[model samples]
Target chain A: MSKNSMKESYKIKDNYNTSIKIKSLVITLICLILTIICLLPIYLLVINATRNTSDILNGATLIPGNETLNNYKNLMALDGFNALTGFKNSFIISGSAALLSVFISALTAYALVVYDFKLRGPAFTFILAVLMIPTQVSAIGFVQFMIKIGFFNTYVPLIVPAMAAPSTVFFIRQFMKSSFPLDIVEAARIDGSSEFRTFLTIGIPLLKPAMSVQLIFAFIANWNNFFTPSLIITRTEKYTLPMMINTLSSDRYTDYGMVYMGIALSIVPLIVVYFILSKYIIEGVALGGVKE
Target chain B: MASNAQRRIKHVSYAKYGYFFIIPFFLVYFIFSFYPLVNTMRYSVEKNLSKEATIYDGEFVGLDNYKHILTSPDKNAEDYYVHAGMREGFLRALSNTFKIWVMNFFPQMILSMILAVWFTDAKLKIPAKGFFKVVMYMPNIITAASVAVLALKMFSNDSFSIVNNTLLNWGLIDEPIQFLADMKLKRTIIAGIQIWMWFGNTMILLMSGIAGINPSLFEAANIDGANSRQVFFRVTVPLLRPILLFTLVTSLIGGMQMFDIPYLFNPGTNRSPGTQTIAAFIYQIYMESRIKNTGHSGAASVVLFIITAALGSIVFYINRDKDEIAAKKQLKKLRKQAAKKAHGGLGL
Candidate 1:
């Protein structure tokens, strides 16, 4: 009876080991497949960006070609190919929007977290409710409002709307709740620091991580914003990177090579920004997930 | 007594300071956002078109515009004029939006969850996982219009498109597919592009959720002779429900507001009637009113706002109820387990 039991146990153990190996192999294969699928479109973008219109239409090669520089030159020579102006517009809009949003959101979060107020619950709930409303729902009204207020075709509409982002406020609030210690606030208060001063000097400094995340989020949102600009900005010279890229298709020449080049050029800044701030972006997204 | 008055003054000053700190955001919000929202709601009730129009000058439309847009058969036709009730174009756009939402949002969520689970599995040590993540997420950082443009090129019906070429080379089809031109194919391709752009964000969230799960729980399940599938279903899924729900709700809201993809895909030249979303439809009405010299675009905006708000609230409420039920079940389970342990000689 003992020998029979030992043999059965050995058989069971063997089955478990085999299954584990199989599961690992299966998962590994799946990951490989997904990674390839995810990377292919980007690879195609790069390849197409390098080739001339004819080569792009004829061949699909994985390697870098000699026509890359020529294609880029042709792209830059196109009408409305003001790379400098596009970059300037994008940077100004995205940077200003990010700074303003982070500041406002952080201050609001600070007040909600450190202060005792009668309307705190209602105020926070209001912000949360705003997060649920789609921005497009108000797109029409916002455009009309912009035109009425004489802010049409200007950066004010873009930068100002971002300041009241409920998502940023919510994120900053969560960060303050979890990461900011009450003892520090109390100590600051005991040291005769006013609430505003404490928030500005102490709270804001401590919120660097959250602020960084908010900056990236706000920047990305503003930078990628095409719908609002499309609706409001009709002037060719006022076009941001996205709006400029959209205008590429409007050209009668229809240079596929130049179009791809423009697409590639438009994405390069974001890729650079991502590489620099990826750590914060990942953490912000993770934290944002935790709250919802 | 003097010090007591000073303390009261100080308290009042602090309250004022709080208000001062919040004032900047309020100012911007009120001017750029809140006022627009209020104006939208107000405009929904009134009919005002001219520069001389006033709240009192405008006749109260009541809910007539909403009724006409929602219930009128004439409004539901594709080629119907924007001013002649609800147009058929608007209905087609609404349906396209919902189709894109279902096709893109759910698959993106599910695939993200699957990828997250696979990445977090202990047995699979995928090399360069971080690199792949960065690559996948790069598209997310790019402007949506640019991505749409790239998608346009890649899915072009021309001989250059990889999709068409591959299919033809593989003998899968005798002719190239017009991915963006045909209605069904257009929606699918657009949804595919959107999913490609967004899945990275979902994957990142799901990965974090999966990472938060305690390893010992899986170990305990393994000790009980549970298979991988069972462990995922019984342990991982229940714990990850909140994150999944969050993804679903956010995606649904985002999906409903989708405009850039369809807009960029169709552009102004193609004017593919079938590719218009409700947002695009609203934009079209606005354009027509501006160009054709009419004021009915305001009416269309009112209708669009109502549809978006109604749909958004319904989804939000449903998800909230589901979340509350799940929370209650978790609480009940904890309580029963506690009671059982209390009645026994030792804790489980």
Candidate 2:
């Protein structure tokens, strides 16, 4: 109620505001430094992709160079590093695998959610059990089985297993548990729709958001998958993008510029996709992180 | 109308349809996953190996392969590398895997925790938070194989590599360091790369975990005159336990399966003993080594499977809905009580 008391209160408030301001400024600077640390490697790769081999060998530089066309030409001329073929093979495998995984996982999740069958609980338990088993455990046997069955060097081994992605089904089922309305399925059935037809017509559309998120994730995972494909496909011409990049480790490929160009090409598409759909991908990860 | 529809839906037996819908998944899984798992176990016990470039499927040898890879020889044995059993190599690989995982996981946890707390703090006036997150997560989405190759190029043991060149230019060292040849430096770089690629992902997951905590709790802390440090240790950490447990279990399982980075970091015959993970060990015996030994690979895989199963069950148990379990227990108790009362009345 007095002028002196008011002045004291104002001084205290000013001190608090300045302290908060200092804290924010310090945190922001830390974040900026972290951002640079994350991007610097990829940035160097891109910049070196444009430089000549001698320049890259001499040292790392921040500026772009004039040898972009030369690097591309050298990469094309290199052996066991066909970028086009690698791209084609990777695209076919990843695209088909993603489509199969999302569709089948959605169907499986739908069954687990929409039905009240006797084996429903048991079926889910089986999936959970399967989820616990890592693929590396069975990898040696898988390769041998495929070899005996004459499926080695074929895309079947890579693509078919996508249909049984327990983790994807589990994630989608989690998404549906909170959002899917059972009444819609009943309404569709009463309107003379067959059960499968109802699922195809109504259930799938309702699950688009979850399906899309899983689709992107599945595609990226399949694309980046190296171990299984490396085990299956041993032929040089049939190599995936990762296999191609891995071959660059041999002592023969001493051309640093060309190697940088190859690595850059492999990662550029994912970066482009990330820049565009990052909001969904980041949110999807957050959604998947929290257990029901 | 709703009642009629409900009645019709109840009368219809969609059970078989559910069976039909899920059959494809189970079928694929059994053929691709379950059968192979069984086959791997069989191989572990069988004499399926290549000797002198000839493949042989000899009689079943129970536990021989496991002992061969797991049992150690005499303590005073000479020429350790020439020993019949590979227990030393296998153990070394397992330890290396653990070392690399621990080296990366602790630093990653600390950095991610700080970033997550800062980003999620409502009081902090952080700018461009979204941009920062996108950039940070960019490394995780890139092909790890490519990232490894990029790392090799950067830290190669020659003067021409990026890292060596930069250090030489900055006058930090008189000569280029042999990064991949030396065990310790190689492990450190591999661990550093692991930290770089994963900290962003861990940060995001932790941020979501922190966000799920009730804001009212923080406000209550503030009203009680608790500082940020006290609030973090008391309010936030306690509430974030479940998610933290989930992260730990998943990270452990993932660490057990770490293959691409360590395997690709030092390719060919020069792979240091310091960085050979379990997965790499399996791959080498079965695929890369001169003598292909499926039995040893299969036996090692069985060990990995057991570890993963144990870890996975912990997650499963923790994730089981507590409320549902309690509700089920209550229902069973009530049913028992009613049954007892009915029997007593009948006797009277």
Candidate 3:
């Protein structure tokens, strides 16, 4: 009787293992299909970028065509959609905002971490409080104020406000709370370094990992910012990538290839950069989420 | 003498430098963010609007903008149609925003929760996990402008459009559907795009939250004869409350500011009435409209702000460090007891 029961339990365990294996296989297949759905649009965007308007009108195709140069020439010739100018404007705004936000956020986080001041608690609390306030709330007043100060149609509104990125400050402060050691600041002080100099020299090096992550995120955010820039900038010459892309939707554009190429140009750099740093970017997002 | 040196060393204050380091942040915040927030409030109460070529900032109009936005227009007024139109527009936009957000959020939460659980499950043995995550998150990084235009092209009303052509080839229907003309379909497409862009992000976040849970708890659940579903509900969801709350609140705040996709999806000068969001409404009134009604837009901005602030405070309340607060209270009580003992049980 004991032998028979032991065999019965073994048979049950084998059945359960087989069922678990089947479930895992089914999940993998579903995930694979979802992955295809996720990437299909982008893949088609690239394929369509190389095809002519006639071919695009016929139907979607999985393969590319020979109209790559034609599409490039047409996109370049398109009015108010200068890819070069768009790239320059986007780069300038995103680069400046990223640098300003990361550096200032690091400095603010450094102060909060290293020094025991009376207002430190209040300051950190203030950062946390304002972290959830979306910029759309004050966009109208910001635009009017910019217009009043003769700062409209310029990069000032876009770049200068980035110095006060509460989210980046909050994230970096959380990062510093975990890993940054205060003994280095003391060591530098013992070596007779000025406080600012110590921050620049030693504090920054220690905070490089956090700073780089925030810098990338800030850059991506500013690069993709269309709402505020759309409100501020009116001139075609000052248009960012997104604004330039918006002009493509106007009824005049019948050339589907050129339009697709215009989009491809805007996203290709970001895709390439993402491919290289996806590990860091994904980790950064996970870190930000868990820390919250 | 050594103790004196140590005390002097400690007295060398770096607190002053803390203020110095933080000066630039505060200065810019005041000038840029704080000032504009207050200025927006001011504009909401003032008669700050333009008609035709005339820009008007005449005088304070106490609660007029709010009343116009919130209340129905009088039928006897000369511009009753315009007033009713604006009132209906605001309410519709508010409702539309809520509807689209709800459509996107519930499914997103459920899917992300399931995916997160699967990704974190030890027994799943999922293949190419990292690649799947990377591909899924790719949509989020793409420019919303491009995504919007891309979706527009794919779902364009013409038969030659990608979706229609594919459907026709598959013999799904006799006629190509007018996706753009139909308001319900348009809103669903927008919500679909939002879900596509955000579900991966939510999944990754929840995965991190789950990964933080102790493995021993899962083992204990297994040993207790609990099935997978039972383990999930009885153990996982309860411990995942804080992260789930954080996700919900942040997603709601973001949904309130939904603009780009819905705005750019329209092929015309104005956003479609069916899918106009609050942010889009505010933009059209303040910037795009011929009248440029700053008063209404500002009022709407304030309303949005109040709602966000209320939502944000919930997160703030949830994220308070309970352990630390309790520790502080205990220390205070002990200090009070010490003082009481020194005072001979409060004889004084």
Candidate 4:
């Protein structure tokens, strides 16, 4: 009787396995379809960016056409499309913002984690609170503050505000708590290393993964920031990529191709950055997920 | 004595270094964020003209601007403020904001949880899971403004729109759908875009939660002859409670503050009240404040602060309750372990 029952159970298991395989195949197909849907806009944008306004208006296909180079040339000829200058401004702004934000956030995280100080809890809470206040909430005040401080229409307004990012501080603090082992710090202290020296020489080096995460986030935030620049920086010369794209789209003459090209160009740097630090970015996001 | 002197020196240096390490964040916070925040509150009460000119000319009109914006009639002598509108514009914006929040949150949460469960299943040999994750998160990195523009082109009312063309070709609809032109459809599309942009983050969070679950629990269930569905429902969902609650609260707070997408979608004109959220309303007020006629943007700012604070606190309170409950369970487990050790045997 026991042998018969075991054989019957095996048969049931085999059938279940076959059904599971069929279900898995269906789910995988659905997931692939969803991925394609998510990528559709990107595909269309790339295709349209290459086509001229006439072709775009005339219902272009998903495939590339002869107008790719012509559209790019036209886009380059536009007032703000001096590729050299545009790139220089974006690089300087995004780079400085990322560096400043990451450095400040790291130091803040270090203090919060390593030091037992009064107001640490409250400060951490305040940082979390500030994360909920959207950038638009303080836009009017921020713009006015920048103007009053004589940083209007320059990189200072663009870069300085991002330096004290509350979310970055919060994220880095969490990372430091989990990843920065106390034993290492204790060992370093035992070796007669000064706290400042330890941080600079040991802590910072060990914090590459966290730093990369913060750097990518800061870079992306600053790179795509539009409203602040739109409000504070009226000069065309100082416009970031997003602001430049906005100008291209909203100007009296709406050049669809140029706008698409500008949008495409604006996103390429981020994609490249993502590929370079894909490992760190994925881990950071995954870690952030668990903590939350 | 040598050790004591070394320790003293270390203590002094550590304190000084701590201050040094903290100075950059504090200085930047004061100069950039905190100062501006305080000034926003201050300016909400004062009157300003042009870039350089501002005065505390008005008597402290506490909540008058809020009342006016929330309760005032439009120039056409119609009551523009809906019942839900407090502090500015019509109430429809607030309702619309909540509506979009509802539309996006439920589906996104459910789908993410389902995906997380499926991805973690042992039977699945998902190839390049990491690659898929990166691709999924691609939309999150894109600028909301650009995404809005792309959506506009793709959902255009014209026949050239890919969505409409595809639908027509498939005989899904008799004619082209006016996606953005219609108010309900526009809001739905906006919510859809938000969900697509946000689900990857949710999926990642849920996946992490699933990963953290102890495998032994699943193994035990399997040994007991439990089916996949039973094991998942019994173990996975319950273990993911904390992360799920965290995501829910954060999503709630973030959803209430939705701005960038809606603003980009409805650029210059306020054509559809359906799409205008509280953030967009605030933007409109700020823009209007630049003109001489409308001098009450500061009031709108004050209103926004109050609403955000109220909502944020409520959500925090809800999350805190769940956290305390979890803490209590952990404490109970610790006590039980201590009792067992004291007794030198497991309780019957």
- Pick the DockQ winner: 3
lDDT of 3 by residue, B278-312 (tens): 99999888887776677889999999999999999
| Model 3 docking grade | medium
For residues A43-84, write the lDDT of model 2, one tens digit per residue.
Answer: 999999999988998899999999999999999998667988
Arranged by lDDT, best first: 3, 2, 1, 4
Q: DockQ for all models, in order?
A: 0.43, 0.64, 0.65, 0.44
What lDDT does candidate 4 reach at residue A59? 62
lDDT by residue (tens digit), candidate 1, A1-292: 6999999999999997788778777766776776677667767777777878777666566876667788788877877666667878988998999898899989988887776666665666666656567666666567777777778889888887888877788778877877898678666666678777888899999998888878878888888888777778888778888888777655364566777778888877677779888777777776652221
Candidate 4 residue-wise lDDT, A1-292, digit = tens: 6999999999999998889888888877778877897787888888888888877766647886567787678778887555446667878988999998888888888877786666665666666666556565566667677766678778887787788887787777767777898777767777778787788888788777788887887877777666677777777787666666555444344567766777777666667777777777777778762221
What is the TM-score of each candidate's chain B when compared with the real chain B?
Answer: 0.76, 0.92, 0.93, 0.78
**Per-residue accuracy of model 4 over B69-173 as CA lDDT, tens digit each:** 567545553334421243335366778888999999999998888888888888776666777778777778777767876777678776666688677767788
Candidate 1 per-residue lDDT, tens place, B2-104, comes to 4554565455535555566667766777777777777666555666455433223456778654544555445456525543535455567778888988999
DockQ metric, candidate 2: 0.64
lDDT of each: 0.73, 0.86, 0.88, 0.72
Q: Which stretches of candidate 1 lie above 4 Å from their native place? A: A1-15, A289-292, B1-13, B46-60, B74-85, B169-172, B213-216, B288-348
Most accurate candidate by lDDT: 3
Better TM-score candidate (2, 4): 2
| Poorest lDDT segment (10 consecutive residues) of candidate 4 chain B | B78-87
True-structure RMSD for candidate 2: 2.5
